[model samples]
Target: MYAIGIDIGGTTIKVGLVDGGKIINSNRKPTASTPEEAVANIVLQIDALFEKYNLTVKDIVGIGIGCPGLISSEEGVVCHISTMKWHNFPIVSLLKKTYNTNIKVSNDANVAALGEAMFGAGEKFNNSIMLTLGTGVGGGIIIDNKIYAGAFSKGAELGHMVIRIGGEPCGCGRRGCLETYASATGLTRMTKSAMEQHPESEMWKFVDGDINKVDGRTSFECAKQGDAAANSVVDDFVMYLSEGIMNLANIFRPEAFIIGGGISAQGKYLTDKLTAYCEKYCYGYKNAPKSEIITATLGNDAGIIGAAALVI
Candidate 1:
């Protein structure tokens, strides 16, 4: 049966009709000020899809929602969402009251991981982990083809894992969290710092001598061109990221490690390096099964598709 997926973001809500791991139709609507208004808008969007596709209420199996913030997936409650200023919101009950069908909810990151695991990069793997390397690092864990959000629906926060004690400060009020060094923002910081130390580095040419212009690509691109300082930055980034991956690998021993977000666009070069590093340093690397590192394929649609998979 068809399933409806809704991805709630700070500025917009993405709704989609999905079947057999494919998005049949989708729409985006401006976020509403209140949860009630948001649910009404979602229903309208779903109605539009139904009308366009000649589907009926009986045609849909369920609706799944992915929202940002601390979500209690088991309870179908959004415990807190800073972007929407929602707290202890009974999202599942609200949706279920309107539709006599399954209504599932989970943290957006975990939902995206589910989407990737079911239909994207982790399709063939029963166990997988997804790491999103954006402004800040985000992560999700999938075990046995299911999202593992932990007992309180607040687990799988891989980015906050401490790799270094008393190192870089993180927004989570922790020092040396993996995100402080492994995110795209972290990479840019590393690049800018390297350029400052090596005024003659070719990385400056890529960013036009403007440190503000430096991004995750600045170091990797320059390093590919044989820039010494850029190479140092890239190496450092790879090392830090690898450390995080290795830590997760040791704990979960997933069959695949899927990398997503902007930096993942680096593709094979980044995955290859990570795979090599993890294989060499991961505990019991030679004795235990190895997890393959790969890039996520779903892109922006991951959220919608993943959310749908919750009820699929």
Candidate 2:
């Protein structure tokens, strides 16, 4: 079966012709200022893809879209996306007028999790949780191979769960949320703090003594070179991240936790620590089967492939 997947972003929109888990053809273009213009662009791309592939829309199974912000998948509407200034847009209905096929819409993070569960790192697991550790932590929970977005599409905001009360302020008007300590932004903050305290740390050299230049990679990269300050930052980051993971592990007990986003680029350096920490501290760790911590395989394609899985 074939499906068309569209991943909508603030700057660009990615569209793909997917055959199962693989993207057979793809196109990307800058996002328009309005939803209607974006849809028109998608129509042009879809027509070109069908013609190039010698297939019609009727030959495909469906079209699926992965969009950011609160989405009502059942209603196929985008409730709100602050970055795009969209509110209550009936996207699926708009597309349905032109194509007679199954159509689905979902949160971008949810689709990325679905993509991973269906064909990426969590493909073998019936249940999985995906944590995207980028600027902020974004996550999606999957149970029995379906997204569990929870009531009113507001659940699964895993990044907001408070790991430490009164520790740090979060953008969501909460203190000590997991996003404050476990995200790339958090890692950068920790690195900056460490750099401030340790004037002799090699991390300063990595970024040419400019604290503003420090990023998520600063500490991890410096730690590999045996820098004490950097290693300390990495250890602290892993500790907070593992604490958050175990909290989810005890509650959901999913088959696996698929770790994605920029920090996941550390690969084994990150997962090995997360697994070890969870195994040592998670509830019933010794008495029950454990969830594996693995890196995401799809990378940027996860959103697109996951949207396809919504219909495939």
Candidate 3:
């Protein structure tokens, strides 16, 4: 049987026809501003998929959705979504009423983790955690091949974990959250700060003195060129990132830590640094088998495949 997976993002909505861990067909559209409009647009895509494939509702098993923000997966309600400005929206109920099919909804990050565990880098392990380093740090945990969302379904807010007691301010109203230092946004901020402090650094030339052009890759690229300033930025980034990874390692001890997001594209350069740092500082490094640090394999399809796995 087949399933429909919908990955709802701040700017786009991805719909896919998935079967046996594969997305046979998919499409994308701009996200609507309102929940009603968003749901309507999704419905249009769902109908289009059915028509394009010449299939009926009976041929499909169910529909799964991965949405941003605080989601109550059991109740299928979105408690809050900062990016979409949605609160207490019963997304599953609305979709079910309109489509008359089984529906499941979950936090986008959690679903992405689930997707990875079921079909991507974590597929070989029964327990794993996925960390997506993007504009913000997103985390999801899998235990015994099942998603562990905690009692309130809000357990895995990994980025919010404080690495520094009083450092840079975070969007979550806290100080020194891991996201403030480990994400792509954090990397850019660090690179910009480094450039400001060292006008003689080559990083300024890479961005042509445009701090706005600095990105997650700037520090890494400059560091590769033997820029001391950029190397310092990368060193600090890896140190704090290792702290967070070690914390999670000691707590969950999952078989692997799957890294995703734009920064993950750095491939072995990123994984090697993370693995080295994790090994050097992770608890019981000498006596225990360390969790492998690896890159996520599914890339963008992880959300869609994972959303579909919710029903499979």
RMSD of each: 1.1, 0.9, 1.2
Instruction: Please write out the lDDT profile of model 3 over residues 242-305, one tens digit for every residue.
Output: 8999999999999999999998988888789989988877889768898999999999999999
| Predicted structure with the largest lDDT when compared to the true one | 2
Write model 1 residue lDDT over 1-312, tens digit each, in one string: 699999999999999999988999999999999888998999899899999999887898889999988999889999998768888989899877778899999998999999999999999999999999998888999999988988898988889999989989999999999999999989988888888899999988898877888888999998899999988888888999999999898788899999999999999999998988888889988886789999999999999999999999
**Model 2 TM:** 0.98
Task: Give lDDT for model 2.
Answer: 0.94
Which residue ranges in model 3 land beyond 4 Å of their true spot?
none
In order, how many clashes per candidate? 0, 0, 0
Task: Tell me how many residue pairs clash in candidate 1.
Answer: 0
Ranking by lDDT: 2, 3, 1
TM-scores for candidates 1 onward, in order:
0.97, 0.98, 0.97
TM value for model 1? 0.97
